[model samples]
Target: MTAQTGSDGPAAPEVSDRIGGRLLAMSLVLVLGTFMASLDSTIVNVGLPVLSVEFGASVTEVQWASTAYLLAVVAAAPTSGWLAERFGARRVWLAAVAVFLVGSLACALAWSTASLAAFRVLQGLGGGLLPPTGQALLARVAGKSRTGRIMSIVGVVPMLAPVLGPLAGGTLLEVADWPWLFLVNLPVGLVAMLLAAWLVPHVPAADRASRFDLRGAMLLSPGLAAVLFGLTDIGSAGRNTPIAVTALVAGAALLAAFLAHALRADRVPLVDPRLFRTPPLGAAVLALFVAAASVFGTMFLLPMYLQSGRGLSAWDAGLMLAPQGAGAVLGSLLVVKPLIDRVAPRTIVVTGFALIIAATVPLTQLAALSDGWLVAALLVRGLGTSMIASPVMTIVYTGVDPEWLPRASSVLSLVNYVGGAIGTAGLAVLLELRLTATGDVAASFSEAFWCVLGLCVLALAGALRLPKTAPSR
Candidate 1:
């Protein structure tokens, strides 16, 4: 990739052909890092039931295995850019890998649910850094023009994780024990650490003489944690308790405070509020938030439909979900970048959202009987998701100045997690309410699917606001 200076400063030296091997090695390391981080999100889900039985814990208690990890990821995400800028991306990335490996080991060795939850939090701390760092590295390596293709390849992991997590987890659970789920990360993370240490070029730290914004970090991290925690608590709290209401209210207030603090800070803030002034960047952020809501919301509901509505076993549900990942990979490989080059990104995003709407419309019509139509719907939805994912990110990254890359990328990552939490919580509450009112699980899931379908339509509307062409930097 060719390197050109952005308005901020001179660009880092491009990786030359002499270092092609090194570039390939670093890319592999990044992909591995991304896979390790994303795999944990879904892998633990399939093991939740086994964990409940093994620990003699209630279903609600065991669910924390997933919830705690997600909350930890949210808490740690804001620090990634600051940490990378202060310490250097290579150092922060290696530290993150080490933390992940250690946390995975602790999780494997844990004897109780509480201990496992704590360890998962450590793992989240490590995992959260991978995405932003990976994106930054790719941005540097691929340069300005090829950012879409490079990011598209990296983007496959998030889509694949839902499918691979359960497949890997189910196979491991059948063959061995639950701890192996955590144990699996050790080898992959170690390899990534080694490769990153060797192949990633060292960029000089950002003018670190500039003081870190500790106050902003404090507010953003806990505020995000509280918000996600409150949302996850809704299912257990029945959404009516004073405690739940208070947690949600406090979390929202803190987040609002964090926003105000970020906006007014004289020094560089943890998140750069000025990026939002750019029209494309602002719209891209909103589109990412809504896209995440549409995608993960369906993921949260689909497996439940397969299990409770279709009466498939956990393993079978996982097997059924595999096609979605396959379709996503296929779509990415075939259409994502080429289509973006030929058409406006806004057009691609709008088309993607429309496809999601098309695919999801069929789910509302699902019956007690299993058939090809359900599988077809999932495949099409995966295609729609893949179609939008990479292009949306490319728009976000390419829209801003290079200095703001980290901040913009971090914001997008943060929105994704928050959107996912909201989506999962909102759909779960809707499904639960419907199930309570009507005895049929299928009917409830069908109602939830339609809600998701509506969200996709909303995302399409937001996509319309995206620039018809890539903006000049």
Candidate 2:
């Protein structure tokens, strides 16, 4: 966390309107990595059905492709901040990209779902570190004052994820084999890597001897996995079995122990608990926690709904999600870019969630809604999603010191994964239970929509604590 941003790294640079061409190039280059990582999170999901058939496995088994990647991403969190600072952001980022490329090639070559999951874990480790490290590097150059606007541009990746990911996955599958899904990242990634080697500036390590927090990493990673495993146990078993209870308890205890270690540490621990002391960062972090769930859980849910509820093909469902992606892109351009730098984050976030809540109202009636109605509702939700995410991320860099930016990104990214897992897993559990108990598919999904609504309300509560206005230049 004490890592230097530059020679005058600690001095806050003024936000210049005329952001130079060099900076913009750097930003775009960094965004390439962000796009790959973010896109991977959803694109592979569209291919799960294909994987199921190819491997002669159940959907439940094939799902580990996505889950294993997510879990690996979570596993990579604690180490990402350290990696960024230890080896320098450039080397670490390139290394991550290389690893991700390797994982992608391996996944393309995988023979079974089990092999794919294993390789994905390797890929997830790299994918997990890229966004946080990339953001930290960009923030180092962009300065806190410019974070809101620049971050808004970066928001395009996530905002467009709902659009490009599924659509691209669906479209690709139409013309090629499933292996192409993983292979596609190769060219794009190589271009990013080569450009990064040439264009991205290097920030050297501040402390070579900054001992890696092996203890903290151990506690945090396993702890998160255990909790997720417990949640999954409940989802699959349909009851709170002894294994679920034990896992839940053990995971809680480990997390508590890690928190105690972080709070009382003399040297900055991995994910220092004290980082929250920075104004509004805590609130922003909390908001992102639930926001991940609300956004991603819905992303997870809607595709399934279309495929299962409407009996559409995976590619069709992916195309059907285009409206939401379109709405998000428009919102980012029209709403977020202008307002994010001027308006209060609290207001923007609240408004975003409001749109989400409104959109979700239609989703609750998925049983009978036409594609037109569903698309319209999703479009609204997409707008809300951009409003919530970009503003909160804006607060992340602006609200904290440059030295803490990497760790801040790490913590925020970590929570986003955990929160998304909780939401997605919970929805899966509920959908499974309701489908079994009621034997009414639409009704079960309709009931799950209520949970998404609840997550939105919960996130809004945190957003209320965000700074009333954008951080001044």
Per-residue C-alpha lDDT of model 2 across residues 1-473, encoded as one tens digit per residue = 24334441242233465567777787888989988987897788778879999999987788779778877887787778888777777788889999999999999999998899999999999999998889888887687666777787786575466467888998988999999989999999999998877677667665543677777888888887778767666655335578878988998998999899888766668888777777787788777778778777788788878888789987788878888888887888789988887888889988998898899988889878998998899889888888877788888777677666788788877877778778877898888889889988789999999999988888777778888865553
lDDT of model 2 at residue 223? 84
For each candidate in the order shown, give its overall lDDT on alpha carbons: 0.78, 0.81
lDDT of 1 by residue, 1-473 (tens): 65544332235466532335556566667878878898888789888878999999976788888878988888888888777777766677778889989999999998889999999999999888888877776666655676776666677676677667877898898899888999989888887777776666665457643567898888888888888888887855235457657878888888788789988998888887777777877777777787788777777788778888778887788888878888888778787746655568887788777888898898887774356877887888888888776877888776666655666667877888888778888998888889889988888888888888888888888788887874222
Best by TM-score: 1
Clashing pairs in 2: none
Model 2 TM-score (2 dp): 0.91
Candidate 1: C-alpha RMSD after superposition: 3.6
Candidate 1 residues lying further than 4 Å off, grouped into runs, are 1-25, 236-240, 368-370, 470-473
Give the Å error, residue 225, model 1: 0.3
